[model samples]
Target: MKVPETALPDERPNTGARPVDYDAELRLHNRAFRHACAILARERVLDIGCGAGQTTRDAARAASAGSAMGIDTSSSMIARARELAAAEDVRNVRFELGDAQTHSFPPQGFDVAISRFGTMFFADPIAAFRNIRGALADDGRLIMMVWQALEANEWSLAIQGDRPQSSAAFSLADPSLAKKILDAAGFADATFQDVHEPVYYGDSVEAALAWIGQFQATREALRSLDAAAVERERTRLREAVAQHHRDDGVWFDSRAWIISARCR
Candidate 1:
């Protein structure tokens, strides 16, 4: 279904920018995502919608025989990726900043393209997938991870308290819709597997609340609300999180779908 444009990251001032904790997220989920990279053991890789280049570097390691390139629409994210790549002294990886729908790659640019929670924001799924297919080699594969459904994910549901009215915020929860769009884009062998995981927060409930306030879009949208509503939402979140805290810290059960397909 078509949705109206609203609250895009670029519209906000460094609001949607990737946070430092995103690296921690990658480190935590890398083991879970390794299977997505396994199929590309000896093939070149492309990471579309790459955020800070973590998975790109991982794919590079997985495909030691071929190079890896990461592309993202956000210039700041691409800049951070380049810096991280240099600091880590990682070779065989490159990054560029441009919209995936319009960006051009060299002929037979990649043998495999991958994304982790990165391909879902596209305004035009078919056009974006077509661009991705154009960038891949004949036998190339594509793998990605996306939220399974809104109700199945607590991480997203927990922070829904303060979210404002926006088309973009509520649009990414449909797996069947996404599968249909991908099929229409000429992708074949489309498959989705459900994976349940836990997303952790800090040792204190307050800290967890603060992290969500800073990073969660729904919370940010609430911040745009009057002070009373914001405080009420904050209180609600704290109470919700208190029930989930343990000796280790605050944690929430989350669910996602690992989507894989081939360019056809």
Candidate 2:
């Protein structure tokens, strides 16, 4: 399936979306989700925006009786994911490069469709959701997780100090907007729930800063700033995260929406 080009312009920064090394954090999120929701063991599943294919591979392993496929727009991510799957010797999982926002799926193909921190950048939320719904079988389910809001997510808020607030335009951060878009997309039984999770950066704060600095959007914002300015922003982020530090380590007070619905 091909992703429509229409929904990308709004979210695409001057530099395209880049590959991120969130391997550990992603695994953690996956584990937490498994705890919260019933695993689709033995159920055919499609993972949209499946970066690195960890979740897809995990699903295939955990649900050995089922088949799993992962799709993403980034070739680098897809390639890396394939390598990871091969290394892990996961035979039932496969990765492909595709646009999830507009990809066409076979009728009654997937029992479950899921995404993690994906779908947040969709330029057209309604259209994106509508296309996703087409991938599922009758009464199939959709499960996705996205940032709740800038204010509630200390990690995003810490990183985005003066960046323009998205309150004006359509944003996935707002749970209300999520419900609205899902409803408009013809899905039923929409629900949103809060999830608090820890994103361990490193042994120290500096390591965490270095890792997060690779974000394309965040880097673009720092492009115009002088070294002093960039450091100032880093200091602010450090202090913000420090508030959440404990004996275990520093953890950002992150928030996400666990949105679910079923196709009619």
Candidate 3:
């Protein structure tokens, strides 16, 4: 399905530019993540690295009487998340600017912790997951949606063809590695469910270009090129993106893993 645009107005002063909707590219993934979460009523949820609070707000809406709190390292993102939550009148959710790895969460405070493509960037995965486990109640759930191997995701290949892939985003692509980390972090019975879906880029080629151009990989690649080479790369990228445009939107095939575990 064509995901509706959830881009909110940028309230930041002096920028005079509409903030890029980072969530647009992952709306379909978010739908699947939400479905996999299946948050229960009265379950206090902690959302790690929740950009703009989209998932946190969804959890709050689902939990109804319960509450959701989102934590992120970006101050701007947290501010924007708060604004969106307030604007949407979602009173059961809140956002905080903090890193999950070292943030001191209230002990045994949350019933569940969730992340959407957010857990892979930790400088120390074991320490981060251990910290998260400390915040959960006995047998509290940990659910996350993470990308699979780079070879399995067409979206990454389309955006970054033949480039050396060193991104931390793919750190947990291996189930064995993920399970080991969880095991050391006091989690047990970890399971991974495969999720195949098309990630939406935008409604048109131009829109897709605008969105993809802001990617770190795109910027780094373009920054290393000479003027003519930069233009050539842009042309190539434009063509690659154009190949994915259709009547619905610019879509790319993606594969992810829905990982679920319980605190031991």
Best by lDDT: 3
Candidate 2 wrong stretches, greater than 4 Å: 1-20, 166-170, 234-247
Q: Order the candidate numbers by lDDT, best to worst.
A: 3, 1, 2
Best by the TM-score measure: 3
- Superposed Cα deviation of residue 161, candidate 2 (Å): 2.4
List, residue by residue over 148-225, the lDDT tens digit for candidate 2. 767876666666777765542226767666778888886888787777776765444444554456656566666767
lDDT of 3: 0.86
Error of 1 at 209 (Å): 2.5
Q: Supply every candidate's count of residue pairs whose N, Cα or C atoms clash at under 3 angstroms.
A: 0, 0, 0
Residues 121-149, model 3: lDDT tens digits:
99999999999999999979999999899
Q: How well does candidate 3 match the true structure, expressed as C-alpha RMSD?
A: 5.7
TM-score of candidate 2 relative to the true fold: 0.83
Candidate 1 RMSD to the correct structure: 7.0
Q: List pairs with backbone clashes in candidate 3.
A: none
- Winner on lDDT between 1 and 2 is 1
